[model samples]
Target: MQQLLDHVAALKGEFDREVFTDSYWAIRDEYDLGAADEQFWPPVFQRAGIESDPTLVASAAAKDAELASTIAREPHQLLLEIADAGVPLGILSNAPHRMAQSVRESDWASVFAHLVFSSEHGLMKPDRAIYDLAASHFSDVEPSTIHFFDDRERNIVGAHAAGWHGHLWRSVDQARFELRSLGILTKR
Candidate 1:
């Protein structure tokens, strides 16, 4: 999230620092999770009463580049364990498009039956619409059978309220333990 803010600041482009900060945050304060960054940046500049640089529009590549470079992605062993146990997996995330595209291109893409990103659907997590949208992807399965794991408590709150089996993610071991309790993990 800091990376996203930094990108916006950089694109503010020679404007007054205070004004840029105010403008950036003003839009963020009322940010519509249903809109993509590509759609969000322009309005921020417009509201600040400045013209956006023609070359400074946000894009999927820009959103992804910093995260891909700085974050170390460890092995998703729990997902692998679940896959080995023949559980149908799905991923639901509130992020930009490139992140989702990267996951789809990953070697383990086959482990998940579906991957839903807010950037593609235009609705983010904690919003009933996105959760319902994800649920629709597994219409054949009962809600009682689905499990969702995320690090954020707020998102888990939303998931729980929506009738998803939500787990606050910590480590793979803890997640496996929880899944074991629910009979979703056996061998691992």
Candidate 2:
């Protein structure tokens, strides 16, 4: 998944002001502002003009959909293929809830068994709580049996720490090969 991670990292640098603004607000709410240091909010919130209620902060995310759709890559097809093989799929992302909605609307939601959005969970990845939440869903399966694919190194590292095998997503080809090597897919 190096390719995916690289691509996302590149996109982070290219993120427009609107996208960053929306992401900042979304993240602020996901972590629960009350527990966060006061220093974290003002600069970001001042730039975005975020208010006390998170819903308004969340609404700032509407600007992201346009930019995100433009960056669509090939890995989602691999995700769908893996899901079609009857391996349960779950999405654990730090994106706002609307981001998941956009993915669902993009004809990909059917592939996912569960979507653990940070906004919905009030916890972001790199945090053990969110990773545990995803793990909890597969109580019948050993943590090692559930493979997680994420485009961020931090998230992948966190998943590993939580006892779930993770694929640090880069490219579709690399991810497919990893799954095959893991015996999740058979060679034709």
Best by TM-score: 1
Clashing pairs in 2: 1-168, 1-169, 1-170, 2-170, 3-170, 4-170
Q: What C-alpha lDDT do the candidate models reach, one value each?
A: 0.69, 0.63
> Residue-wise lDDT of candidate 2 within 56-155, one digit each (tens)?
3333343444344333457666766787788888777775555655765666666777777776767888898888998788778788777888888988
Clashes of each: 0, 6
Q: Candidate 1, 124: how far from true, in Å?
A: 1.3
* Best by the lDDT measure: 1
Candidate 2 positional error at 75, Å: 2.2
After superposition, candidate 2 runs with Cα above 4 Å error: 1-60, 69-73
Off by over 4 Å in 1: 1-60, 63-75
